[model samples]
Target: MKDIQTHDRQRLAEKLRFLEPDVIEVITTNFCQQHPETKEPGEVDTTHCITDARYHLTFLRTAIEFGTEETFRQYLRWTTKVLQTRNIPHHVLQRFLEEIFHALEPHLTDSEKLVVRTHFLDVPESGLTERQTPARSESPLALHQEVFLQALLAGDRHAARTIALEALSSTHSLSDVYVEVFQESLYKIGSLWESNRISVAQEHVATAITQYVMANLYTCVTPSQPSKGKGIITGVEGELHQIGSHMVADMLEMQGWDIRFLGVNIPHQAILQLIKEFQPTLVGISATMVLKVPIVRDLIKDIRNHFPSAATPRILVGGSAFRALPDVYRDIGADAFAYDLRTLTTLLS
Candidate 1:
């Protein structure tokens, strides 16, 4: 029964994807006609409405593909807070969601419409209260993490690098810096962006600073022993979040693995060609967005098809996607899913 619902949702998502442009147009037109106040200068204009409609549909499609409303619900909750922070009235958000549902109605079957309506039934109410600071981690390097995060938020690359290097020089190991500082800080930055506590530009700046800091710290990471095995780490296609993958590659290299870190959004053919040339012992794929899990699954399938069972590299998956659905890797035929660097190294060992 569950599998049948999942299939229906998948089909619905695919259909919506095909009709995205038309659906978005209908949503924008209806929203404008229903709310003329939004068309005023400096208000939510047609362009903004179109963009929001696209994102709304995209998030809904992802939720359907996941076979759970939790994904869409979470996005709606975050968006509600963000809109409230921007002084956009709560009613406008509600109206936008309603417009989306009506726009999609013409394209969906009665059953599919019911599934979509379920996703919209419990819209989150907006709150005007200020977002509280995220709680501090209990890690010993918590202080360093806090300082590093503030530095990144402030766009002080030098301070961020110095904090990371200083922590590495102290009693803290490279793993501590990566996990307790970099990973934790990035997570907090994501939360801030979702809550509208910080702008997207600020979040990008923080990520860039962290990447810079990681590069500087790489100079200090020397393997103490011979190579354990060859490995390739990359983000799945269309996945722009590569910092976590980069950290995994660096840690693996430090563990005496021959690591090749291919950047994000790599093509399937490119990955296969690399596998043929490199013949790695392990291939680590990262997909930060839950929506990209299907792409990861397909990539894994391609790898299996192109290589004999005995020749295929041990496929390991990770990132934020698997954090919520830890067993999904097994479902996708991946050999393993690592939540963090320690788990990954432990699995390899």
Candidate 2:
């Protein structure tokens, strides 16, 4: 095997720059105080923090390698420790537990893992007569892989790049592992939230981690074009929840969109100027939260007013918040609302 390098360590260091200087310092101090032998303890703090994000869960092989029945059980029992801390909320702890356990259960012994799945994970053993069984192929996930996730959760940008390079060298790209495995892991986080097995704060921890994790992924992949792929995609003013937009951006670029991604919080006049500047073949807007409807409506109006030549470059609206209020689209006035990335691709060029 090729030697593991400092790329992961560096990611942790860079991410520390974004954190509360004191929080990073404290984590470093604590990690050093705890494990001094590791010369690169700076990044280790991020790796340590992400275990709670449940990166271990989706990549079952990784979880099986780093996770223990003991750790898994403790995550399940996070409320006790959190309660003792007296600072964190109960839901926060619950979300941490749910994500890790859901992803790991498929690899764990049926009897032990099933207990939580039956009670949580949103999948019932009694329901699916045909379920996937664990395999050796599913085990042996690298420590660096789990560490990369931790780094991203902790906002350790350097660690993100480092582990990403490490993964890339091993006959696979991070995207090779990311698209399906990690996506499923995130789905588990959402499933836990929708089911009430985990608390909202816990869900936010996972969501925050998941969102930033994608941000980290952007750093690893070299940009073929500065504006995403080669074109442009954006959301309306006040519509943020770039998660859905990011996914669509990735998928669209893969399908040759030459992407220009204008992430959430864009305003009306700004978008009009952007439309004129970029002259994109298509315009995609994502609305994951509710308040974006008005912003989107205004965006459509401005697009027509300024770029009347383009008329409509396939306006698209997506995300859970928009999906929840399909009725609002009549008021907002978009050409289409996509359920997922593939559908969005079909709707546009």
Candidate 3:
């Protein structure tokens, strides 16, 4: 691969930030085909597509297991469309299916690459099965998000997601739920996934279901409330995680700050450009994988260099990677380590 240009790298990182597996493959195939080397189903392009496909696929698998079907189906259509048109490689497709639906692989019972192989035959048959009866599980919600989520978890994701939508709509602000209600629920779900009580797919399902409900609520948000200070949060060039930043954006928004969410896998230059353009009060960086830690440190250093003329926005760092080495925050020259959303209350204060 060529030395990726700074802006284009960020664009690629952001382009398919949260795409499902099938969609990522579709995108990779299209992207590879657009380039000279990747046009054919060669081994090199196949490898690249496979790697990228897993990122999208794993997330979707998690979502399907935990989130509402409404959320799963919403993106399912988009993914299916991409699969239908994009010329993805065979083995790569199989690998993606294997990762997401691991348990089902054994059930293939001697069939030759049965799992993803069949799904690969046609894009439309990507198994976005809405008609399958969800087992009745949760109590119907007259009000409360608890009831909604309980219902959602119980197999009536359609109803759960719908109620969540109503709850989000009733909120005076799009960001209102994040501080306590949403954050707490997210943490609980994470715990469930971590404890092995729920699978990664289930966690993903919950996030997808919640995100869809939130997206609808966000659209209705309309920024009716007046703004305060502005901020931007992004993952460094090589990093792909965006969950922590989502929390920051919501917290800042709830606190009346105008936040610009540049999103996952953003490059140093793009962030710098936004900083220069928006003149935000703080710049937040999130890194989920430890291997990407240097990217975060370097990005902060670069941002510091670019804003020499005035008060550089405070740099904030957070994510799983930082959990082990909280001291790294100081070494990296970040002004704040937003270890939690509440940390911002003090920093922004």
Candidate 4:
């Protein structure tokens, strides 16, 4: 039975490679037909059509390469997000998944058939059943962004901690403050620096203050229970942005994962050594700049080559770099790419 399963998995991979172009065409055609609004009259290219086709193609490639329950779920969840962004109805997204299944049916072996049947075919059609995407109202912490920013700018770590603690003391989840308060504030700071409204030194000072504030809140978030699993979060070599990765580390730590956070610009040797020593269940690497992307890709390549198949950790990639470049994570060999803490939580959940 194991041998049969292995053969079927390999067979599916091969078929996916050979049939990709055809599969993409099928998916794109179905998507266009289902949502005629996606097609613009007398236009050589439409945003929806291009994005839809690329999304399906990337999904197929990533799904085939990873072929795990977690990866499959990421694909589905990402599809739902894409559909929601386009303001397309949830039901249309449901039909899209169904079309992908139909498009690949002929290529699936009996064993593969059962795999997709359970994971894809019979999976919850939540997108189809739901009338619309659930509304995500503004976070209450967002209302205090000005206060947080002011404190950080003033280099008042005390004031920042007070604000964060007050939010955490409220009904808000730790995850909420991490996203709205820290992430969004840093984003605003960066924008200010970019527009010359704030100096580079000011940006650095604000970020340092915010990091200090995050440190102070750690005691509040530290889990009492045993760890769920081990996790390693870091910025790839040549990547200087550690705050984003640090936020992820905190989130995982709060969730009771024995997490090792290797701060900015860690070498491949150190990372590989730690992974082998720690044998973590998950590894998250971040690259804030586009130039650092190649470092991430190389890191993944080395990890795959050095580690035995079973011992390999589930790799996740994130950062502003991937946020700007859509679907690049699929090509970079990471199991999943999270655009932010919210998506990261969803991916892990």
Find the candidate with the highest TM-score and give its number. 1
lDDT, candidate 4, at 247:
88
Please give each candidate's TM-score.
Answer: 0.88, 0.45, 0.51, 0.61
CA lDDT for candidate 3? 0.57
- Candidate 3 per-residue lDDT, tens place, 84-113, comes to 334443334434444444433343344323
Residue lDDT tens for model 4, 21-109: 78777776666555675554455544566566656545444344434444445555655554554456566656666777788788876
Cα RMSD (Å) between model 2 and the true structure? 18.3
Candidate closer to the true structure by lDDT (higher is better), 1 or 4: 1
CA lDDT scores, all candidates in order: 0.83, 0.51, 0.57, 0.74
**Candidate 1 local lDDT, 212-251, one digit each (tens):** 9999999987764646989999987799989999999989
Candidate 3 stretches greater than 4 Å from native:
1-158, 162-176, 219-227, 309-311
Q: How close to the true structure is residue 246 of candidate 1, measured as C-alpha lDDT? A: 96
Instruction: Report the lDDT of model 2 for residue 123.
Output: 30
Model 4: runs farther than 4 Å from truth? 1-137
- State the lDDT of candidate 2 residue by residue for 24-73, as single tens digits: 34434444344433222355444544432323232222112222223333
Ranking by TM-score: 1, 4, 3, 2
